[model samples]
Target: MAAAAAAAASPATAPCFPSTHCTRPALISLRFSRRVKVAASTDNPSPAFNSVTAFAPATVANLGPGFDFLGCAVADASLSLGDTVTATLDPSLPPGTVAIASITSPSRPSLATRLSRDPLRNCAGVGAIAALRALGVRSHAVSIHLTKGLPLGSGLGSSAASAAAAAKAVDALFGSRLPRDELVLAGLESEKAVSGFHADNIAPAILGGFVLIRSYDPFHLIPLSSPPALRLHFVLVTPDFEAPTSKMRAALPKQVAVQQHVRNSSQAAALVAAVLQGDAGVIGSAMSSDCIVEPTRAPLIPGMAAVKAAALEAGALGCTISGAGPTAVAVIEGEEKGDEVGRRMVEAFASVGKLKATYTVAQLDRVGARVIATSNLE
Candidate 1:
């Protein structure tokens, strides 16, 4: 809840887009069987519930060297921060119509209003549509209401949270039969509104814990189990500003050097291994080693280096830009050290960077997105 201002990206060679650098083993697509017919039943042709509300946790994409391929959920007892989506089915409305009834943020109303009402331009709307499409429910209309908790464009996976919550909420209202990965794809449909098909944020927000996006063509995801004893503590410093995903991505070079590529590949492997083994020291060192994207994006964030150095000096294992820019994450050994690292991060931003910043201390969220509430309106 403390306010302190802070800010890093990738080391791909040939100036390649960070996503393209994450090699895929294959580029196959999943094919579904022909649609099936459902027999009418007076027992209950409609879903059991009229409304379903879901909560999706915020995520940190990239996590240093894992650019566009790695991310983890950020959750804490006091920081139940994310986006919530409530979906209500209206049988009387025309088929194939998804309406965004309202979007509101009790804490930040202006931001809520800023989001477009169009389903294609809005994450929650797109999520609902994708879910319905997956369920073959074109005959029914669903009204979506979004309650925003995470700030938009703060590099905390704001769009992904909203999209994941909407996808989960809609699926729950429909019956919750969709496979987990199917639901994730539905969420990914919404993420396209942000620019590309990157799932570093979307996958982790939907699956929880730490997620590695192995491929996007067939859309494969692998969730890694971290050591319980390691207990990853995160200090997130976000400035009162906006760094659109498109702008940040545009800042990347079209390619990178071969030498940079080799170094980046090695560091990425090390970071992944560190996470799996619960080696805090190794994880921190590898995370701070992003040579490509972070360097290009550093000038966009004032005092980025100073804030990162401050966090390290305050006992943080490593610090880097959360995703895009402006929001910085500091990995610490234990929850007890969160306050010190966070304070130093913010102080550095304000004094050295001259930017006001706010931060929160949280642990990696293992639960992902889920239906928090449901109701029947008879």
Candidate 2:
């Protein structure tokens, strides 16, 4: 204790730490001895980390009224990716400069070697890696592995979640020299590659909460304040089916009816207001408030009306499409009703043949996406 106290009081006698390098903006620390430690504090500066790993959550984008502009986070859906730092010569790297060490799903088996492809594609691993390449960050090479827990293209922002997670992992692995906003931009770049257009789903996955992407001269995002009285809960139903995003986008009419457009826009504003006011009833009511595409696209998914009816009867606040469709999302006032809503949804599916569909009750996950681990420090 006396020796430690003396070392702490005496900077000259304390074990000398790295004070030469400041290439990366991120600060890191490593403990070398019982009485000596290496750190970059307010009085110390050192080289940043060289590697990292990221974990991002699946997102529900364009939730009903907020098409192409709004999104929310989910807890159950998640993805992870790992990488190698290229700025310095390090080990644990494969030959292709950057390589995918393993993949949890065989969804996109061939993408492991396609460096030019966007990492945000249907298979999350590929999309994340691709997004990194687009950032012109070849100075760092990454070996990644992605876990696909969310339903792909089932109206859940699976690609966005994967891309954001991968982007975060890459940044952290490299000592997080990139700014928070820039890291989000990099995630969006990956999403664009797979979705073929830019949206805010991936950005807020890193930032958290409900985000509104205002595509103005100076692009900005507006996050709505969430209320505590309104308990967050959801009933997600995935039918024994799939709908490709490409097809669904093509189905949307480029030009909407003038009245319908106005109504949808109004509902979007109302929904945002409802959240701030802590009005669960209004929030659920607003879920059914979509007049733009739901009416036009409802028939695409079989047993839609019956499922919705069952969800409502089971005490759900509102019932609507999860993201695109096939998967229905139902809102509950509180978690107590969660099981009931789920059962009702399942019953509804049973009426049409239980073997044809499945549903689960979930909550509105406000935590957003984030990483769970790291590899090394520069």
Candidate 3:
């Protein structure tokens, strides 16, 4: 197995956050696609065991123009608590067996307090169970734990991280039979329960790096062929407020101007090209070029303009509302710039009122999901 390095190369190109510019090709195009190339593939195998631990990264959904079709994994996401699944040694029971057990993140207790219960329903856990069920490993008892790092419903793909981690852990417990796409689908299904029927957050979280959800029929997902030499930094500012996903969706305008739509499409495509070619300048330009969602959502969040301005002034490539709103993200060059930009974003949020802002500095995660440990009761 390859030793874990500090970090892998850029997932695809030097693209600034997920931006949706163009309508995906009507037909799936696997040939000459730039989204399939990745610098790393962690596929070391292990025997089915009794317990496991998994970490899932936070993800940005509807990146700029990609709008549910595109997204990228951000490192340092929340850690879904943990789970232990193993076959119970009971001669009295039937030959085939299946059972599930869940544990809460020590940080918080009581399902009522949790935004989403049925931990198995969580994106990370759902992906894990879906993988196990697909493998046909029906005879086993499993236990799960969760670690909540990112705030749920903050548009940070918080639930996706939990689901991805749990899904990967379940795969390990069952001897890792499911393919990558299957796991991604599992997470997507879990996402449907809370955030309505559609969201691209789980796809990138499952596969890692950048993903373009080109289709749902047989799921035509492609990992972007990002430039390895590129390094994009970010400042994610999460404000202290819970903006229900349902309400946020209702705030969107159903109609848009024709010219605004055209500009958005053109700029979104430009963002993709910039990422593919590793041009920060072009990507940065695209970050502020949004004609579809941000304008309408901006008013819902306080201090949007000021916070974004601070991020830019602090050397950010571009800035925008992260995931939904309230949480804003700024794209930058590297760690130094990320730190500086993050500081500015926090300060920017203060002008609104007495609000707490969580400033996160992150990079594009290149690798998808994997199991750190696992166990199966057989």
Candidate 4:
């Protein structure tokens, strides 16, 4: 069952905080009934397992004009395009400690080697620690093993995926008592340590579907509904280039003209409305209408304009850069259309940008982070 319960709250519209601030918004209060069913009481404090494995899907943040306020989880058909984390109780380690056992990526071995093993420096470890603190469990230490399925700096929420998976795995190892909001908060803390204090990527990765982060100071999130008729497919073409989140963020304009802000705000609202109305065409159109951030960052990415144009020309509903991308994402209606649009975008990258590229076709992942396996102590 999905973690969040249906609740009503007005959407918040505060701009993102300055880069120096360490504090972030909190997720609105909502209990996870599914977790509550299995929560262990103080009298029966024994853990449900000694080890657990969890998966969190890759995510596309910003969604064009939404900036740091909107994101959605996405996965390929096999659901093999995200991060997996395994957390195990280690009695030998010091109590209340979280450590990284290994970081390996079967798909991107070189990228895996680049990640740090220090728990405080790594998202997975930090996230596990955050979850443990939230659970008030310091009886045993945790050893984390992270398998990266997505490349870092791909604008695919790589760090957020690891953090979400680790947070879920550690929480489940103790009995899955943490509410969905707390899990998201853990992911946010991890992101703040590694990326920035933004929940756009982590929230969707933890809760699934499209999430609208209404406010950062008060930490309000509204999980947008996906209409049944919205059969949207995303074609993601990632070029052989690095566009780090820090660098992409630095490329943003410090201030936007009032007219441009109004235009982009309307587009963001239209995109949200399109999702609620199940209008795929409008969703695509609204997603491609971002004028401020996109315009500022597009020039930094070679062939981005051509790639977007090519995707549209190849019958994509709309095309834009995913996250702080070198990855160009296009929205389409069907698998076949995704294939064609992906091919054209990749070709544009190679021909116009002089860079090799790869593409993945994915659907929205409604279920967020989840445990795939567990082993109990004898």
lDDT of 3: 0.59
Q: Write the per-residue lDDT of candidate 4 for residues 1-378, one digit (tens) a residue.
A: 011111111112111111221123323231111111111223323478989999999999999999999999998877688999999887766555566788889987886667766554557765776777667664566788899898877888887898899999989998998888888987886786445678999999999889999997787899998886678889989999977667778899999999999999999999999888888898899999999999988888999999999989999988888888878889997677888888889999999999999999998888888899999887
* Candidate 2 per-residue lDDT over residues 242-263, each given as its tens digit: 6665556667888988898888
Cα shift from native, residue 156, model 3 (Å) = 0.6
| TM-scores for the candidates | 0.85, 0.74, 0.77, 0.87
Off by over 4 Å in 1: 1-46
Q: What does each candidate score in C-alpha RMSD?
A: 9.3, 13.6, 11.4, 8.4
* 1-378 per-residue lDDT for model 1 (tens digits): 011000000000001111211121112111111111212212222464789999999899998778899999988774467889998886554554566777888888787667755444467766776666666564556778889888877888888898899889878887886788888988876675364678888888888988999997787899987888988888999876666676778899889999999899899899889889999899888989999888887778887899899999999989999988679999987799999899888998898778899889988888889888999867
Each candidate: what lDDT? 0.75, 0.55, 0.59, 0.78
Q: Of the pair 2 and 4, which is ahead by TM-score?
A: 4
lDDT over C-alpha atoms for residue 79 of model 3: 33
Error of 4 at 370 (Å): 1.2
User: Best TM-score goes to which candidate?
Assistant: 4
Clashes of each: 16, 12, 48, 1
Best by lDDT: 4
